[model samples]
Target: MKKKFKHIKESQLTITELMLPSHSNFSGKIHGGHILNLMDQIAFACASKHSENYCVTASVNKVDFLNPIEVGELVTLKASINYTGRTSMVVGLRVESENIRTGEKKHCNSSYFTMVAKDEAGKSAPIPGIILTTKDEIRRFARSITRQNEGRHRTSRFSSKIFKTDAYIHLLEESNSKIELK
Candidate 1:
């Protein structure tokens, strides 16, 4: 069977919600966990739309909260297919918060979610490839590949079977931690 491909725009999704007091932390800012939940939802929606199969989040890349969200602000989350593998896709998400009264917008977070398409039997399923139409799309696809490679290397380096504590023990000496090897 021939492989199928889809343009990045075909599966793009965007959602906006108004922040409320119920979603804020004790510090009066919108909670990071709430934003993360929204991001995951968008990622799932984008991936499922592109693959036409149910998708589950396999991993989430680094997430940094760049700006605090006010309770009355409108938060918008945008998701797009950045890269696609045989059974997985990287959904790149960007979040921004806008003050309703002033129309000022601030970037709150940017993240990459790795999602795997699943068949009705709950097994991983192949997904359509992405059509990179712009330089930005190409760059994002390249970034996802690089990130995956780095993740594999990092995991192997710290795996229990091959990890050497001594090799990294001295590196943490300056930190506020004590090494008590039994």
Candidate 2:
């Protein structure tokens, strides 16, 4: 069979929900966990739509809560496929919160979720490649490739099997830490 290609916008998804008091933490801000759950759901939806198959999250990249969402705000999340491998895709998510009364908007989070399509037998399945027609789409694809390469390099450098403690111990001296060798 020939390989299939799709445009990123074909499967793009956007969802908006009102922040409720129940979703807030003790400090009265919307809980980070709640936002994360919504992000994961959108990621799954986007990936599934793009692949036309059931998908599961393989990993979640950096998630930093840049702004606190308050109760009564409208939280909107947008998801799009940034990169597509043979069996996996990177779903880019952007989260923003808007004050319903004042109409002020703030960026809350940006995250990347890696999802893999699954076959009926629960094995990895091939997914369609993405068509990059615009410069922004090309940049996102290239960024995903760079991120994956950096992750591999970081993992290998810190792998327990070959990691050298001495090489990193000196670096910790500059931080707020005390080194006591046994």
Candidate 3:
């Protein structure tokens, strides 16, 4: 049986929460960990909504914090499926912060989470394909494919057996790290 295809809008989700003092770090800004937790939640929600099955975070690809979120601001997170595999989907997440009084908005972070759909037996399950309707949707899907390929290449190249430490020793010398090879 073939799985039904779903559209991006079908599983898109947005969450807005007021940043509290409790969610702040020592510097009095919203904690990055807290934002990551929220990102995971939204990714899971979006993936499950699209797959109609339990989903777990397989990997978090990229999490770049562009701005610091203030405790008094309103933080919003948007999530949607960028690409789908046999049992996995890449959930693209964007986090933004808005100052309540000034109405100023800042892009706080952007992340990509790979989620795998699970069956009742906790095994990998088949997931629906994405229906790309617009140019932006097509571009996102294409970018996901590129990211996946690059990840695979990196894993293979850096695998224990394949990696040659001596070949890249000079690269490390350029950094602050000291090679205390025993």
Clashing pairs in 1: none
Q: Please give the CA lDDT of all the candidate structures.
A: 0.96, 0.98, 0.94
> Can you rank all candidates by TM-score, best first?
2, 1, 3
Write candidate 3's Cα lDDT for 33-100 as tens digits. 99999999999999999999999999998788999999899999999999998999999999999999
Compose the digit string of candidate 2's lDDT tens values, residues 116-138: 99999999999999999999999
The digit string of per-residue lDDT tens for model 1 on 13-64 reads 9999999999999999999999999999999999999999999999999999
Query: lDDT: which candidate is best?
Result: 2
| Candidate scoring better on lDDT of 2 and 3 | 2
- Residue 25 CA displacement from its true place in model 1, Å: 1.0
Preferred candidate (lDDT higher): 1 or 2: 2
Ranking of predictions according to lDDT:
2, 1, 3
The runs of at least 3 residues in candidate 3 whose Cα sits more than 4 Å from the true structure, single-residue gaps closed, are: none
